[model samples]
Target: MNLKTAWIWGLVSAVLAAGALAAPAASAETLRICSDPDNLPYSKAEGAEHGLYVDLANLVAQKLGAQPRYVWWLSMNQRKALRNTILAGKCDAYFALPADKDYGTRGMKRTQAFLDVAYAVVAPPSFSFSRLADLKGKRIGVGFASTPQIVLAAQGGYTTVTYRTDAEILAALDKGEIDVAFMWGPAAGYDNLTRYHGRWRVTPVAGEHMDHQVAVAVPAKDAALLARIDAALTELRPQITALADKYGFPQGQPVAVGMAQVQAGPADVALVPTAAGGTPYGQPSPYRMMAVAAADPAAAGRELFNSTCSHCHSPNGASPIRARDLRRLKGKYGDDWLKEAKQTIEEGRPDAGMPTWGGTLKEDQINDILAFFKTIQNN
Candidate 1:
């Protein structure tokens, strides 16, 4: 169903459900959540209702014993629209706020942030960039009106190309249209590693406003509603983290991989294609494809790394900070390296500053990522 219609239906559902419970039914407990329709790794209509946030909403509904309804709002131009919905009583809460002071109003209350995310860089393998400074003179892609554009525009120097969504930006990156792209952390990281075969380095930037907390917005008119949400959030935060890990959003730092001697690996390397595959760039593979177009799994891994992961990791599996070189992971990481690599490749280090890949990267592709790690340092 269309997003607009779905919204109206959802609101109706909530009010009707509340009405069915008899007049003045104890404490008012129906919760209507307003969110974006197409914002992925955050909220969506398909699987997991779009990720951790939706799941968290479900958890909250269960905790409150209230009917959970959804309202799909356009992500851009959200503030004014949200205010209208809340004041009109169409929605009890609006999630995905930047937790900014600007959000609160006469009928709006802000809950503590359950998720903290930021803008990050997604680049192809052949390019090299260890730090923010490496973006110099390089062409970078950005989503229009996103934090990345705002920051880079002020920072100056590098050439900036703009797109409207993470899908579009990643497509361009895959096609060599841009040297790098700055995008929403979870969406970018998950899409790249899984759909793109871990073929890109998603690097988070550190600075003012780069990282922001996501909170639930409630109608200021209902103090009780606000407090309930806050309490529910406290109860559900840990579950929320687990949900984020279930997807491929990076929790901590970006994965690092060195390019030195790390050529393409085997053809058996299972690769994941971006969501936008086939229609525009290329068709999405029913079966996984190698990160690189090489026949050798290791060589393909190396090619993929150099074309993508190498941008953030060192040439010989080292990174100054933002990313860690994968090749250095073996001996340096000790006996736990394999298991750690698997976890890092699959779950992503959410607490330790890494995105999970368990949901995104296929087993073979992950094997390729690990194989590439082993090739270096030992060589």
Candidate 2:
């Protein structure tokens, strides 16, 4: 070959070799994020609308000159999901976690909070609420055993109707069965825009556990990575706000709900008491359950049960839904109740909407949950 052609070929070979060597570094630039697959307004795996968290992850990764990669898992139980995903080293980061210092993060480092999550009052556009007294005599719908239910229970002059999910609460509001629905803000707002076509106004409420800031969580060891993520988040703040708006996240000033009254100890402060003689819902108060949990020998088991099973079984396994109510396990299954419960948990009745835990949860963890169940079963 001619010297000129040989030189050109040599240069091309060198460039190709350099590109091949740099391929690994380019691949390493992927930002692996753990997120809920089906959680709307937060994330979804198979959709054009991939939810706020997914979009934000993409944006942040872009800002950091990295590509976004997702490790999708059902996050019905946040703690369990975190344990199985990010904590298990399946991903580099989790899309979001409560930014509260007291919140159990399982030894994960968190970036500065980028968003506010709260219980919101979802009502018709015509409805206006500036203060807690405005809810007096109003039929407020809340999730069973949710913060809103507990808070409203402590206050007088308001009636609360408990529902299983945010969807149900919003449905009741749409049907006019309730004057207002107090529930998770992002969920209510997303449903209002997507399901109800922006028919209702979702106003965020402030108080104690009522509102919290959310941040991205990374492994505690990933200090440098966490710093980079935080820097990217700050640079992308406007874009993040835009994404929240696109997803219909409730923003602006939150109305001060009467948590002070609840904390101050209301006169009829039987937090989880049955609705008798003008009381509201009959769901078990989480605070009361926490106190009971603290004293129980199976406290670890109780925590596991609440973290893993409570989404379907309800808090403390005291579900009002007959099929899900574990308290009646002994009554319904006779002497073989424990066996039935264990088999059901391990094998999962998919037809009945239960997912198999055998593969995901450790045998010891399952046993602990079963031990806790034994304590709650009513003969």
Per-residue lDDT of candidate 2, residues 1-379 (tens digit): 4323332343444355457553323332556789888888888887678888878887776667665667887876666777898889988889887787756555799999999887888888788988877888887887755777666655645667766567777887888878998888888888888899998888998876577787899998999999999999999889888988999999968998755677655543444433211001111123322233334437657755664466568789999999999999899999999899989989999898887777656666577777888888786
Alpha-carbon local distance difference test for all models: 0.61, 0.74
Q: Which stretches of candidate 1 lie over 4 Å from their true place?
A: 1-28, 46-48, 124-130, 144-159, 162-165, 254-379
TM-score of each candidate structure, all chains considered together: 0.55, 0.67
Candidate 1 per-residue C-alpha lDDT over 95-117 given as tens digits, one digit per residue, 9 for 90 to 100: 66757565344567788877766
Colliding residue pairs in candidate 2: none
List RMSD in Å for every model shown.
17.8, 11.6
The most accurate candidate by lDDT is: 2
**Ten consecutive residues with minimal summed lDDT in candidate 2?**
275-284
